[model samples]
Target chain A: MTRTSTLSPVPPADAAAEPTRVAVSTVIFTLRRLPGSETASVALPLVRRTRDPHEGLWALPGGWLDATEGLDAAASRTLAETTGLAPSYLEQLYAFGAVDRSPSRVVSIVYWALIRPDEIADASDENVQWFDAASLPGLAFDHNQIVDYALWRLRNKVGYSRIAHGLLADEFTLAELREVYEAILGRRLDPANFRRQVENSGTLIPTDRFRTGSHRPARLYRYNQDVELADRGPLDRRQ
Target chain B: MTRTSTLSPVPPADAAAEPTRVAVSTVIFTLRRLPGSETASVALPLVRRTRDPHEGLWALPGGWLDATEGLDAAASRTLAETTGLAPSYLEQLYAFGAVDRSPSRVVSIVYWALIRPDEIADASDENVQWFDAASLPGLAFDHNQIVDYALWRLRNKVGYSRIAHGLLADEFTLAELREVYEAILGRRLDPANFRRQVENSGTLIPTDRFRTGSHRPARLYRYNQDVELADRGPLDRRQ
Candidate 1:
């Protein structure tokens, strides 16, 4: 494309700046059982950048968006290519386009995804490593801020939506479910309060199956299939 | 820039497709009083396109994003340029990048803004016009879908956050505040129930001033300065 075609809307004075490029990145979160800890914690995989603009620093798994693909498709592609894992739940988080975010003029359309522990496949490699979302090191670009925002969104969504089901199995005891919430919230919740709240929410369906634990025999529950995991409005159809 | 620089991350075959351009657009919603109506309706300004690709059709006020500007800055700049109105609240809504959304490969970082009825400025011109957001005609590109999502978000957010205050003035009666909610919700709310809910939320501060109406004088109230209009997570710092 000539300078006049794509750059027509931009004035000649502003045209001297490089054209803005688009990139797709994903903050994939999952429940990981940390060593010496019974409760799970939120964790995400990061790719160590080999090139400048913060070489050797960990960054979100992403790549430049291919013009032929849609934004959602690009997010999924880049995530799978970089992390070698496919997430169960993915949603667009935000578009970060701070001029100083990267060396080049680029806009990153960041997506946050949720992976069920059962589906996490071969995530850690030589260049890729999983880090606790809360205790992440200095990441490349503005990724630390991005991860914080994603974690906030995850915790916020868990309160009103049925998103916590993405972290658990098809059927689990209430205690297990409570653990997921406690992990994401980073605090212990009153078991009685958690049970009453989940029951009132009406998103859970109690199953006849039971899990016999050391404390007591607990009933297993599954998410109501009729209800969506999260309400993403009209754009959820693509997902 | 060489073909290997910005487009390097994309494969040679994928790079054959045109490099995507970033554009910033805003759905600036404001409450406008209609003729022969007591309550206001949600309305937004649209610019009539004068070039090909849905020429003569109405579209959201926007322009191609300049690389030198950040996403938020571009949104504010393009919004002010296309529509001569500055809004009270503006937040990033979503990033729309469906391959078929436009004739050219364009990814629009859409923002939804709220304008208080008092701060609305001269908005009508030969090319730009305000249309009822609920009953908009066929718009250019994928703007109709974008507007629907924004309206959905506005309604959903009002249920949880104090964002409805953005559409209100500094001080208002319970009846006036209810009208703003009723207008955006497109339905009447129980007056007593609405009062009890907002009061219980602890976000309002009753003032000495009152609105003397035909029925009874109702006390006015202002938003609690300590509470933010909306909880935008860490990104709230930017706004």
Candidate 2:
């Protein structure tokens, strides 16, 4: 159902006016391998805030929520404005509404979006860079909190859900997929067991493509388009 | 690590004087079965707003976040103010910050809290009453969205996690516990299978005390305090 509201631009004279609230921000993340390493790692997009409210500080790329748009739409718009990136997968994260969270009385509803590393690379721009999740610099506002929560959710969700696939290319080998899980989880998984579990889950459909130039040719697979993993039972059981 | 914000509050005259944000609220829930029922049902504690901005509207009791308190504390305080109740289980839910969600400029960070029905019964006052989830009326602000998300999470989460036990008393029978699950999920579960799954989860510890009642004495169980389910595996896998 769509929710719409028509609000007057001005408040009644007798009523005390509250501060205007409108800002949309995002914490976009992707899994990337560190230099000289085959093991994957979590990375977040960072932009140096050019204006006040923690100007010059490293923060997630975001800006004001538009007055005439949905919060989700505003998030994508803000990310595009700040980093020139459009995320393929976006979902609402927690809202930060502490009265003093912003220098002004600004409350930010932060959305977390996942972009495949390849997607980010294709749309790469000069100002934006992905930093290792562990070595992030001090962030502006309550952004660090947002990042923490997103990381926590990502790590936890990857176990039972096929969300980790969102971080990989469309067609990937079993070894590459396992690396994605291992990276976010910060632990090494038994490669054979991990592949077995993933295949048994029925979320992945086998593709004819195979990866070459490795020690051996590895089979490639794509996510099942018709299979909405979240709706499936037994397979969708909480991790 | 404690993250301390060092950005000084911008003066009102500064160009960075952003509009103050709005408050988002949520009513977290769990089912409480009254004595006469064979099945349990969902319930939420609500308060009548005594002031404007939807004054006198029956809403999920909440208010704007204070300047000094964190979002979590603000949510806890708001819940306490309305129902005189404090939930043992509380977490950040999605934030609702539609520009027109509030009559005033207030962005809310809605939170979902879970509590045993009996624990909150004592706090029920003139303004507070536990209403069946299905029978809720039009709520103030965007509370309907908050409740919907919470219920969705509850139903989805109870499958693998022992979170349902948080809604029960210190010790409860398998039937009563199963009722909690069935009520939230809105499905009738086979008693034999439910028992088997719960037993296999190993999160519940059997108690020596049997629940003495009209028919047969049912076995009592309690949440196993010793084990940390969240730490057992990845967040999703732990469940």
Candidate 3:
């Protein structure tokens, strides 16, 4: 994705004496079925900070941005460190740079990701743990607000993108897919409307597999990889 | 809008000896009626750099991220320095942080803006000049590519948001509004369909004003101020 065009060549400014440092953080979202419950909800991984201004509190998994690495590389590194998996779906959420966000001035280029259920199988690590995004307690820094924005984005993107693939298994029945939306949106959708919308989107590929239930079995479908996971426009092709 | 939630309280990482610096830049869009042409086109302001590296080459207006300023403040400062006006219809576009983007390690937090026609009246300056977004010359650094991405965002946003308010005047006839869309989209939209879509959107408030010409008078419509300029979700309320 390296290009002469997007590659900037302007001279750097005179460095500030007490220069602002950059940090890369992530809000990686996944869906977890509540213990002893049939319903699922949006969840994310957070690392209990070994040390902090707010010590012992959970924080989004991230590390300092190395001068030698690009922002995306730094984010992917953070993901691997926490999840032990390659980045499946990732996008920059925002750059949080309040002068007082931290005791020292640090700007966090935050990213949000969606890890499919299959991808979450090997993400176990002692330091990092998954928490329901809706029920988080006092988190480090402005993390609580950050998670809310990320959830809003995830829910909003689901409306227009085939990003459910990033949360669901490789194959899912329409009912199962609807559950993903219902969880994020916190409400039920008309089953018939949901079917027509995804059908018209043309991103679903019907599969022979079927889920046998107490009633009639429902055929499964997977996302068409050829169709874009989402329309990020130029960012998609450049990356 | 300040909440204790989004603020980070974690201790800062060991500062790199030579830390990556953050710079702010913006691509501000407006409609310009090219000389001898009735149709307008999407355009933006660029300032000629006075210092070396890309000296004399036009670049997106920006400056160093002051140690005490937040990312939004820095972006708004850049916008003010460029246009001498308060930030209008601005959004963080992307954070470009390629290691080799500059000779020095610089991470640029870029923003894109839309300036209404009436707002462009006072944006006259010698160092800064407007360039057609489609036909930008080899700009300073990655500005050519940056502008392309900004324009892509502008076009994509136009399809789903009432951001047309940011480019159009206080009250405009349907024909005038359609021109703004055609200019950004670079193609003609069916008038009947455009009318039906916008009318159904219910974001327009019919005004007593009308544009009388050779054709029958056309009623003018203004955006419903109560309606948001665009659905930015959580960021709108937070800001």
Tens-digit lDDT string for candidate 1 (B1-239): 01011223323454434457888888988888898997789998888887777777889988888767787777777777777667755788899998888877888999888887677666446777889988999998899999999999988876423654677777888888888888889999999999999889888889999888697899989888778766778874452
Q: A109-169 in candidate 2: lDDT tens per residue?
A: 7778677777764434444667898778888877777687788877766542355456767
What is candidate 2's local distance difference test score?
0.66
CA displacement after TM-score superposition, residue A129 of candidate 1 (Å)? 1.4
By summed lDDT, the worst window of 10 consecutive residues in model 2 chain A runs over A1-10
Best candidate according to lDDT: 1
Q: What is the lDDT of residue B231 in candidate 2?
A: 42
- Quote model 3's iRMS: 9.2
Tens digits of per-residue lDDT for model 2 on B167-194? 7777888888877778887889999999
If ranked by TM-score, best first, what sequence of candidates would result? Answer: 1, 3, 2
**For model 2, what TM-score does chain A reach?**
0.82
- Highest TM-score model number: 1
User: Which scores better on lDDT, 1 or 2?
Assistant: 1
Candidate 3 lDDT tens digits, B1-239:
11011223332354355567788988888888988997889888878776666777888888777776777788787667655656465678888887776677888899877787677655456767778888888887777877877877787665423655787778888888888888888999999999998888878888898899899999999888888666667663322
Task: Provide the lDDT at A120 for model 2.
Answer: 68
lDDT per residue as tens, model 3, A68-104: 7778888888667655656565678888887776788
State residue A13's C-alpha deviation in candidate 1, in Å: 8.0
Please give the ranking of all candidate structures by lDDT, highest first, separated by commas: 1, 3, 2
Better of 2 and 3 by lDDT: 3
TM-score of chain B, candidates 1 onward in order: 0.90, 0.81, 0.86
Candidate 1 wrong stretches, greater than 4 Å? A1-17, B1-17, B159-164
